[model samples]
Target: MLWTITIACLLLAGLIFRQSFRKRNEEIEMAGDAGLAILEFGRAFPGEAIRAVISTANGRTVFLRLHDGKAGCMNAHGHHYSCHLIEPGMVHVTGAGPKRLNVKFSNAAFEGGMFEFRDEKEAAEVSLWLLGSFMPGLAAQNPRIVGQPG
Candidate 1:
Protein backbone atom coordinates (compact mmCIF):
# COMPACT_ATOMS: atom_id res chain seq x y z
CA MET A 1 0.00 0.00 0.00
CA LEU A 2 2.81 2.43 0.75
CA TRP A 3 4.49 1.61 -2.57
CA THR A 4 1.22 2.28 -4.41
CA ILE A 5 0.87 5.67 -2.61
CA THR A 6 4.42 6.60 -3.54
CA ILE A 7 3.79 5.72 -7.17
CA ALA A 8 0.63 7.83 -7.20
CA CYS A 9 2.49 10.79 -5.78
CA LEU A 10 5.21 10.39 -8.39
CA LEU A 11 2.63 10.35 -11.14
CA LEU A 12 1.05 13.52 -9.82
CA ALA A 13 4.41 15.22 -9.66
CA GLY A 14 5.20 14.21 -13.21
CA LEU A 15 1.93 15.64 -14.44
CA ILE A 16 2.57 18.91 -12.68
CA PHE A 17 6.06 19.11 -14.10
CA ARG A 18 4.79 18.47 -17.60
CA GLN A 19 2.11 21.11 -17.29
CA SER A 20 4.59 23.66 -16.01
CA PHE A 21 7.00 22.92 -18.81
CA ARG A 22 4.27 23.32 -21.41
CA LYS A 23 3.20 26.65 -19.96
CA ARG A 24 6.76 27.93 -19.98
CA ASN A 25 7.21 26.89 -23.60
CA GLU A 26 4.06 28.71 -24.56
CA GLU A 27 5.31 31.90 -22.93
CA ILE A 28 8.67 31.61 -24.65
CA GLU A 29 6.98 31.13 -27.99
CA MET A 30 4.82 34.18 -27.41
CA ALA A 31 7.86 36.28 -26.56
CA GLY A 32 9.69 35.04 -29.62
CA ASP A 33 6.75 35.92 -31.80
CA ALA A 34 6.54 39.36 -30.21
CA GLY A 35 10.21 39.91 -30.90
CA LEU A 36 9.69 38.94 -34.52
CA ALA A 37 6.75 41.30 -34.76
CA ILE A 38 8.94 44.08 -33.41
CA LEU A 39 11.52 43.33 -36.07
CA GLU A 40 8.90 43.37 -38.84
CA PHE A 41 8.01 46.88 -37.65
CA GLY A 42 11.42 47.80 -39.15
CA ARG A 43 13.54 48.40 -36.07
CA ALA A 44 16.69 46.51 -35.23
CA PHE A 45 16.42 42.89 -34.11
CA PRO A 46 15.04 42.63 -30.55
CA GLY A 47 18.00 40.41 -29.58
CA GLU A 48 16.30 38.30 -26.88
CA ALA A 49 15.09 41.14 -24.68
CA ILE A 50 11.38 41.91 -24.46
CA ARG A 51 10.98 44.44 -21.71
CA ALA A 52 7.22 44.58 -21.32
CA VAL A 53 3.89 43.75 -22.96
CA ILE A 54 0.73 45.77 -22.37
CA SER A 55 -2.73 44.62 -23.37
CA THR A 56 -5.15 47.10 -24.90
CA ALA A 57 -8.83 47.48 -24.11
CA ASN A 58 -9.57 46.72 -27.75
CA GLY A 59 -7.80 43.34 -27.57
CA ARG A 60 -4.45 44.35 -29.02
CA THR A 61 -1.01 43.97 -27.46
CA VAL A 62 1.62 46.68 -27.35
CA PHE A 63 5.21 45.64 -26.85
CA LEU A 64 7.66 48.28 -25.63
CA ARG A 65 11.38 47.89 -25.22
CA LEU A 66 14.84 49.28 -25.94
CA HIS A 67 17.33 47.73 -28.30
CA ASP A 68 20.78 49.03 -27.45
CA GLY A 69 19.19 52.36 -26.35
CA LYS A 70 16.76 52.85 -29.25
CA ALA A 71 13.10 52.39 -28.38
CA GLY A 72 10.79 50.07 -30.31
CA CYS A 73 7.04 49.62 -30.40
CA MET A 74 5.11 46.64 -31.75
CA ASN A 75 1.34 46.69 -31.71
CA ALA A 76 0.56 43.01 -32.19
CA HIS A 77 -2.54 41.13 -33.20
CA GLY A 78 -2.01 37.38 -33.08
CA HIS A 79 0.97 36.63 -35.34
CA HIS A 80 0.83 39.95 -37.20
CA TYR A 81 1.83 43.34 -35.81
CA SER A 82 2.28 47.04 -36.58
CA CYS A 83 5.64 48.28 -35.38
CA HIS A 84 7.80 51.39 -35.39
CA LEU A 85 10.57 53.22 -33.64
CA ILE A 86 9.54 55.61 -30.87
CA GLU A 87 11.14 59.02 -31.22
CA PRO A 88 10.84 62.22 -29.24
CA GLY A 89 8.25 64.64 -30.58
CA MET A 90 7.06 61.64 -32.56
CA VAL A 91 4.94 60.31 -29.71
CA HIS A 92 2.15 62.15 -27.95
CA VAL A 93 -0.18 61.26 -25.12
CA THR A 94 -3.70 61.74 -26.35
CA GLY A 95 -5.62 60.43 -23.37
CA ALA A 96 -5.59 58.22 -20.25
CA GLY A 97 -7.23 54.94 -19.28
CA PRO A 98 -8.63 53.67 -15.98
CA LYS A 99 -5.55 51.51 -15.86
CA ARG A 100 -4.32 52.20 -19.35
CA LEU A 101 -2.99 54.90 -21.67
CA ASN A 102 -3.76 56.18 -25.14
CA VAL A 103 -1.12 57.61 -27.43
CA LYS A 104 -0.61 58.92 -30.94
CA PHE A 105 2.55 59.12 -32.95
CA SER A 106 3.94 61.46 -35.58
CA ASN A 107 5.54 58.58 -37.42
CA ALA A 108 3.91 57.95 -40.75
CA ALA A 109 4.64 54.25 -40.49
CA PHE A 110 2.06 53.73 -37.78
CA GLU A 111 -1.16 53.85 -39.81
CA GLY A 112 -3.79 54.62 -37.15
CA GLY A 113 -1.39 56.94 -35.33
CA MET A 114 -2.51 55.59 -31.96
CA PHE A 115 -1.89 52.77 -29.49
CA GLU A 116 -3.30 51.79 -26.09
CA PHE A 117 -2.05 50.00 -23.01
CA ARG A 118 -4.08 48.19 -20.38
CA ASP A 119 -1.79 48.96 -17.45
CA GLU A 120 -1.59 52.68 -16.72
CA LYS A 121 1.68 52.36 -14.88
CA GLU A 122 3.22 50.44 -17.77
CA ALA A 123 1.87 53.01 -20.17
CA ALA A 124 3.47 55.80 -18.22
CA GLU A 125 6.73 53.97 -17.79
CA VAL A 126 7.04 52.99 -21.44
CA SER A 127 6.17 56.46 -22.68
CA LEU A 128 8.61 58.10 -20.32
CA TRP A 129 11.30 55.60 -21.16
CA LEU A 130 10.92 56.19 -24.86
CA LEU A 131 10.94 59.95 -24.45
CA GLY A 132 13.80 60.01 -21.95
CA SER A 133 15.86 57.73 -24.16
CA PHE A 134 15.75 60.34 -26.88
CA MET A 135 14.92 63.88 -25.74
CA PRO A 136 15.99 63.56 -22.07
CA GLY A 137 13.96 66.28 -20.28
CA LEU A 138 10.82 66.01 -22.38
CA ALA A 139 9.60 62.87 -20.63
CA ALA A 140 9.65 64.67 -17.28
CA GLN A 141 7.68 67.55 -18.75
CA ASN A 142 4.97 65.35 -20.16
CA PRO A 143 1.81 65.64 -18.04
CA ARG A 144 0.53 62.15 -18.73
CA ILE A 145 1.00 59.96 -15.71
CA VAL A 146 -0.64 56.56 -15.60
CA GLY A 147 -3.44 56.20 -12.98
CA GLN A 148 -3.44 59.96 -12.48
CA PRO A 149 -6.16 62.39 -13.46
CA GLY A 150 -5.15 63.60 -16.90
Candidate 2:
Protein backbone atom coordinates (compact mmCIF):
# COMPACT_ATOMS: atom_id res chain seq x y z
CA MET A 1 0.00 0.00 0.00
CA LEU A 2 2.81 2.44 0.90
CA TRP A 3 4.63 1.59 -2.33
CA THR A 4 1.53 2.42 -4.38
CA ILE A 5 1.10 5.78 -2.64
CA THR A 6 4.75 6.68 -3.28
CA ILE A 7 4.36 5.90 -6.99
CA ALA A 8 1.30 8.11 -7.25
CA CYS A 9 3.09 11.01 -5.58
CA LEU A 10 6.04 10.65 -7.95
CA LEU A 11 3.77 10.76 -10.97
CA LEU A 12 2.05 13.89 -9.72
CA ALA A 13 5.40 15.54 -9.12
CA GLY A 14 6.55 14.75 -12.64
CA LEU A 15 3.47 16.34 -14.16
CA ILE A 16 3.92 19.51 -12.12
CA PHE A 17 7.57 19.74 -13.10
CA ARG A 18 6.74 19.43 -16.77
CA GLN A 19 4.15 22.17 -16.53
CA SER A 20 6.55 24.47 -14.76
CA PHE A 21 9.20 23.88 -17.41
CA ARG A 22 6.79 24.66 -20.19
CA LYS A 23 5.72 27.91 -18.54
CA ARG A 24 9.32 29.00 -18.08
CA ASN A 25 10.04 28.33 -21.73
CA GLU A 26 7.11 30.44 -22.82
CA GLU A 27 8.22 33.34 -20.62
CA ILE A 28 11.72 33.20 -22.05
CA GLU A 29 10.42 33.23 -25.60
CA MET A 30 8.26 36.28 -24.90
CA ALA A 31 11.24 38.14 -23.46
CA GLY A 32 13.33 37.30 -26.51
CA ASP A 33 10.69 38.70 -28.83
CA ALA A 34 10.48 41.92 -26.83
CA GLY A 35 14.24 42.34 -27.01
CA LEU A 36 14.16 41.83 -30.77
CA ALA A 37 11.58 44.56 -31.20
CA ILE A 38 13.76 46.97 -29.22
CA LEU A 39 16.87 46.09 -31.20
CA GLU A 40 15.11 46.89 -34.45
CA PHE A 41 14.27 50.32 -33.07
CA GLY A 42 17.73 50.79 -31.57
CA ARG A 43 19.21 50.47 -35.04
CA ALA A 44 18.54 54.18 -35.43
CA PHE A 45 21.42 54.81 -33.01
CA PRO A 46 23.71 52.23 -34.57
CA GLY A 47 26.57 51.64 -32.10
CA GLU A 48 24.77 53.50 -29.35
CA ALA A 49 23.44 51.76 -26.23
CA ILE A 50 19.77 51.22 -25.57
CA ARG A 51 18.21 49.92 -22.39
CA ALA A 52 14.70 49.05 -21.26
CA VAL A 53 12.95 48.22 -18.03
CA ILE A 54 9.53 46.73 -17.50
CA SER A 55 7.41 49.47 -16.02
CA THR A 56 4.79 49.06 -13.36
CA ALA A 57 2.36 50.78 -15.67
CA ASN A 58 2.59 47.99 -18.26
CA GLY A 59 4.73 49.83 -20.81
CA ARG A 60 8.28 48.82 -21.55
CA THR A 61 10.30 51.89 -20.75
CA VAL A 62 13.24 52.59 -23.07
CA PHE A 63 16.30 54.71 -22.46
CA LEU A 64 18.46 55.61 -25.44
CA ARG A 65 22.00 56.81 -24.90
CA LEU A 66 23.76 58.11 -28.01
CA HIS A 67 27.40 59.13 -27.80
CA ASP A 68 28.24 60.40 -31.25
CA GLY A 69 30.73 63.25 -31.50
CA LYS A 70 28.23 65.80 -32.72
CA ALA A 71 26.64 68.28 -30.29
CA GLY A 72 23.03 67.87 -29.20
CA CYS A 73 20.02 70.04 -28.51
CA MET A 74 19.89 69.37 -24.76
CA ASN A 75 23.34 70.65 -23.81
CA ALA A 76 23.30 73.58 -26.19
CA HIS A 77 19.89 74.75 -25.23
CA GLY A 78 19.07 76.89 -22.21
CA HIS A 79 15.56 76.54 -23.49
CA HIS A 80 15.34 73.14 -21.76
CA TYR A 81 14.57 70.16 -23.94
CA SER A 82 11.47 68.22 -22.94
CA CYS A 83 9.03 65.87 -24.60
CA HIS A 84 5.75 64.07 -23.93
CA LEU A 85 5.61 60.91 -26.02
CA ILE A 86 2.01 60.25 -25.15
CA GLU A 87 -0.86 62.53 -24.33
CA PRO A 88 -2.77 62.91 -21.04
CA GLY A 89 -3.78 59.32 -20.32
CA MET A 90 -1.54 56.46 -21.32
CA VAL A 91 2.19 57.13 -21.30
CA HIS A 92 3.93 59.80 -19.28
CA VAL A 93 7.31 61.40 -19.90
CA THR A 94 8.60 61.35 -16.36
CA GLY A 95 12.15 62.51 -16.89
CA ALA A 96 15.01 63.33 -19.33
CA GLY A 97 18.71 63.75 -18.81
CA PRO A 98 21.92 64.27 -20.75
CA LYS A 99 22.44 60.53 -21.18
CA ARG A 100 19.20 59.05 -19.88
CA LEU A 101 15.46 59.49 -20.02
CA ASN A 102 12.61 57.81 -18.15
CA VAL A 103 9.13 57.01 -19.37
CA LYS A 104 6.27 55.07 -17.85
CA PHE A 105 3.15 53.66 -19.43
CA SER A 106 0.37 51.27 -18.57
CA ASN A 107 0.95 47.97 -20.36
CA ALA A 108 -2.76 47.64 -20.90
CA ALA A 109 -3.05 51.30 -21.80
CA PHE A 110 0.11 51.57 -23.87
CA GLU A 111 -0.79 52.88 -27.27
CA GLY A 112 2.69 53.44 -28.70
CA GLY A 113 5.57 51.12 -29.35
CA MET A 114 8.83 51.63 -31.26
CA PHE A 115 10.15 54.55 -33.26
CA GLU A 116 11.71 53.68 -36.60
CA PHE A 117 13.74 55.98 -38.77
CA ARG A 118 15.87 55.30 -41.83
CA ASP A 119 19.65 55.77 -41.81
CA GLU A 120 20.92 59.17 -40.85
CA LYS A 121 21.88 60.52 -44.24
CA GLU A 122 18.68 59.66 -46.00
CA ALA A 123 16.62 60.69 -43.01
CA ALA A 124 18.28 64.11 -42.99
CA GLU A 125 17.91 64.58 -46.73
CA VAL A 126 14.20 63.93 -46.75
CA SER A 127 13.08 64.71 -43.23
CA LEU A 128 10.04 66.48 -44.63
CA TRP A 129 8.74 63.14 -45.82
CA LEU A 130 9.19 61.55 -42.41
CA LEU A 131 8.45 64.58 -40.27
CA GLY A 132 4.90 63.73 -39.32
CA SER A 133 5.45 59.98 -39.15
CA PHE A 134 7.22 59.51 -35.82
CA MET A 135 5.54 61.94 -33.47
CA PRO A 136 2.41 63.54 -34.77
CA GLY A 137 1.03 66.80 -33.38
CA LEU A 138 3.91 67.15 -30.92
CA ALA A 139 5.92 70.01 -32.33
CA ALA A 140 2.99 72.19 -33.15
CA GLN A 141 1.87 72.61 -29.56
CA ASN A 142 5.20 72.64 -27.75
CA PRO A 143 7.41 75.73 -27.76
CA ARG A 144 10.73 75.23 -29.57
CA ILE A 145 13.77 74.89 -27.34
CA VAL A 146 16.36 77.16 -28.96
CA GLY A 147 20.04 76.48 -28.51
CA GLN A 148 22.37 78.91 -26.81
CA PRO A 149 24.70 81.00 -29.00
CA GLY A 150 28.11 79.50 -29.56
Candidate 3:
Protein backbone atom coordinates (compact mmCIF):
# COMPACT_ATOMS: atom_id res chain seq x y z
CA MET A 1 0.00 0.00 0.00
CA LEU A 2 2.82 2.43 0.82
CA TRP A 3 4.53 1.66 -2.51
CA THR A 4 1.33 2.43 -4.42
CA ILE A 5 1.02 5.85 -2.70
CA THR A 6 4.65 6.66 -3.41
CA ILE A 7 4.22 5.88 -7.10
CA ALA A 8 1.18 8.11 -7.36
CA CYS A 9 2.99 11.01 -5.75
CA LEU A 10 5.95 10.58 -8.06
CA LEU A 11 3.70 10.59 -11.08
CA LEU A 12 2.03 13.78 -9.92
CA ALA A 13 5.38 15.49 -9.46
CA GLY A 14 6.50 14.46 -12.94
CA LEU A 15 3.34 15.85 -14.48
CA ILE A 16 3.81 19.19 -12.74
CA PHE A 17 7.38 19.42 -13.92
CA ARG A 18 6.40 18.71 -17.49
CA GLN A 19 3.70 21.35 -17.40
CA SER A 20 6.10 23.98 -16.13
CA PHE A 21 8.64 23.13 -18.82
CA ARG A 22 6.00 23.44 -21.51
CA LYS A 23 4.91 26.83 -20.27
CA ARG A 24 8.49 28.10 -20.21
CA ASN A 25 9.05 26.90 -23.75
CA GLU A 26 5.97 28.76 -24.92
CA GLU A 27 7.25 31.96 -23.36
CA ILE A 28 10.63 31.51 -24.98
CA GLU A 29 9.02 31.15 -28.37
CA MET A 30 7.12 34.40 -27.92
CA ALA A 31 10.25 36.32 -27.05
CA GLY A 32 12.32 38.32 -29.59
CA ASP A 33 9.44 39.13 -31.95
CA ALA A 34 9.45 42.82 -32.83
CA GLY A 35 5.77 43.03 -33.69
CA LEU A 36 4.76 41.37 -30.46
CA ALA A 37 7.07 43.61 -28.50
CA ILE A 38 5.59 46.69 -30.09
CA LEU A 39 2.08 45.42 -29.54
CA GLU A 40 2.71 44.63 -25.90
CA PHE A 41 4.32 48.01 -25.35
CA GLY A 42 1.39 49.73 -27.00
CA ARG A 43 -1.02 47.89 -24.77
CA ALA A 44 0.94 48.99 -21.72
CA PHE A 45 1.15 52.63 -22.86
CA PRO A 46 -1.87 53.53 -24.92
CA GLY A 47 -1.18 57.25 -25.21
CA GLU A 48 2.43 57.10 -26.33
CA ALA A 49 2.95 57.18 -30.07
CA ILE A 50 5.96 55.28 -31.25
CA ARG A 51 8.09 57.10 -33.81
CA ALA A 52 10.94 54.63 -34.03
CA VAL A 53 12.01 51.27 -32.57
CA ILE A 54 15.54 50.13 -31.91
CA SER A 55 15.81 46.47 -31.07
CA THR A 56 18.82 44.78 -29.62
CA ALA A 57 20.62 42.21 -31.72
CA ASN A 58 19.14 39.41 -29.64
CA GLY A 59 15.71 41.10 -29.72
CA ARG A 60 15.21 40.71 -26.00
CA THR A 61 15.07 44.50 -25.46
CA VAL A 62 13.46 47.25 -27.55
CA PHE A 63 13.95 50.99 -27.27
CA LEU A 64 11.29 53.30 -28.57
CA ARG A 65 11.38 56.90 -29.69
CA LEU A 66 8.04 58.54 -29.06
CA HIS A 67 6.53 61.27 -31.21
CA ASP A 68 6.50 63.61 -28.23
CA GLY A 69 10.29 63.26 -27.91
CA LYS A 70 10.17 60.95 -24.93
CA ALA A 71 11.84 57.56 -24.94
CA GLY A 72 10.74 54.19 -23.62
CA CYS A 73 12.11 50.73 -23.08
CA MET A 74 10.56 47.26 -23.11
CA ASN A 75 12.27 44.18 -21.75
CA ALA A 76 11.01 40.65 -21.97
CA HIS A 77 10.24 39.05 -18.63
CA GLY A 78 9.13 35.46 -18.96
CA HIS A 79 5.66 35.50 -20.56
CA HIS A 80 5.32 39.28 -20.37
CA TYR A 81 7.33 42.48 -20.75
CA SER A 82 8.26 45.20 -18.29
CA CYS A 83 7.69 48.59 -19.89
CA HIS A 84 8.97 51.87 -18.53
CA LEU A 85 9.06 55.44 -19.78
CA ILE A 86 12.52 57.00 -19.72
CA GLU A 87 11.66 59.96 -17.58
CA PRO A 88 13.92 62.94 -16.99
CA GLY A 89 16.47 62.39 -14.20
CA MET A 90 15.32 58.81 -13.86
CA VAL A 91 18.10 57.19 -15.81
CA HIS A 92 21.84 57.46 -16.28
CA VAL A 93 23.71 56.18 -19.34
CA THR A 94 27.34 55.75 -20.29
CA GLY A 95 29.10 54.13 -23.18
CA ALA A 96 30.70 50.87 -22.12
CA GLY A 97 32.24 50.05 -25.47
CA PRO A 98 32.01 50.88 -29.15
CA LYS A 99 28.69 49.09 -29.46
CA ARG A 100 27.51 48.77 -25.89
CA LEU A 101 25.96 51.07 -23.30
CA ASN A 102 25.89 50.81 -19.55
CA VAL A 103 22.46 52.02 -18.45
CA LYS A 104 21.45 52.61 -14.86
CA PHE A 105 17.90 53.37 -13.81
CA SER A 106 16.82 55.11 -10.65
CA ASN A 107 13.76 52.95 -10.36
CA ALA A 108 14.53 49.89 -8.33
CA ALA A 109 12.05 47.72 -10.09
CA PHE A 110 13.63 48.33 -13.46
CA GLU A 111 16.73 46.29 -14.17
CA GLY A 112 19.50 48.13 -15.99
CA GLY A 113 22.54 46.57 -17.62
CA MET A 114 24.95 46.77 -20.49
CA PHE A 115 23.02 46.82 -23.75
CA GLU A 116 24.85 46.00 -26.94
CA PHE A 117 23.72 47.44 -30.26
CA ARG A 118 24.57 46.62 -33.80
CA ASP A 119 27.04 49.44 -34.14
CA GLU A 120 28.43 52.55 -32.55
CA LYS A 121 25.84 54.73 -34.26
CA GLU A 122 23.01 52.79 -32.72
CA ALA A 123 24.63 52.99 -29.31
CA ALA A 124 25.05 56.72 -29.70
CA GLU A 125 21.46 57.08 -30.73
CA VAL A 126 20.22 55.28 -27.62
CA SER A 127 22.48 57.41 -25.47
CA LEU A 128 21.01 60.51 -27.05
CA TRP A 129 17.56 59.29 -26.29
CA LEU A 130 18.44 58.91 -22.61
CA LEU A 131 20.16 62.28 -22.61
CA GLY A 132 17.29 63.94 -24.43
CA SER A 133 14.79 62.59 -21.95
CA PHE A 134 16.21 65.05 -19.46
CA MET A 135 15.27 68.15 -21.45
CA PRO A 136 12.61 67.31 -23.97
CA GLY A 137 10.41 70.21 -22.93
CA LEU A 138 13.08 72.84 -22.58
CA ALA A 139 13.45 73.49 -26.30
CA ALA A 140 9.72 73.78 -26.89
CA GLN A 141 9.27 76.01 -23.87
CA ASN A 142 12.01 78.42 -24.89
CA PRO A 143 13.75 78.00 -28.20
CA ARG A 144 16.41 80.58 -27.32
CA ILE A 145 17.40 78.65 -24.24
CA VAL A 146 18.72 75.71 -26.23
CA GLY A 147 22.29 75.84 -27.57
CA GLN A 148 22.80 79.18 -25.78
CA PRO A 149 25.80 79.73 -23.56
CA GLY A 150 24.82 80.24 -19.97
Q: Point to the candidate with the largest TM-score.
A: 3
lDDT of 3 at 147: 42
Give the alpha-carbon lDDT of every model.
Answer: 0.57, 0.34, 0.82
Worst 10 residues of 1 by lDDT: 139-148
Each candidate structure's count of clashing pairs? 1, 3, 0
Regions of candidate 1 where Cα sits further than 4 Å from its true position: 1-59, 67-69, 112-116, 133-150
Tens-place lDDT digits, model 2, residues 31-150: 334354345444433544332222111122222222221110011012121212222234433223232233344544333333222233322322221222234344334435111232
Q: Which candidate number maximizes lDDT?
A: 3
| lDDT tens per residue, model 3, 38-78 | 88889989998887788776667889887666789999877
Q: Tens digit of lDDT per residue, candidate 1, span 56-89? A: 4454555565533346666555556666666666
For each candidate in turn, give its C-alpha RMSD to the true structure in angstroms.
9.7, 14.5, 6.3
Q: Tell me each candidate's TM-score.
A: 0.48, 0.34, 0.72
TM-score of 3: 0.72
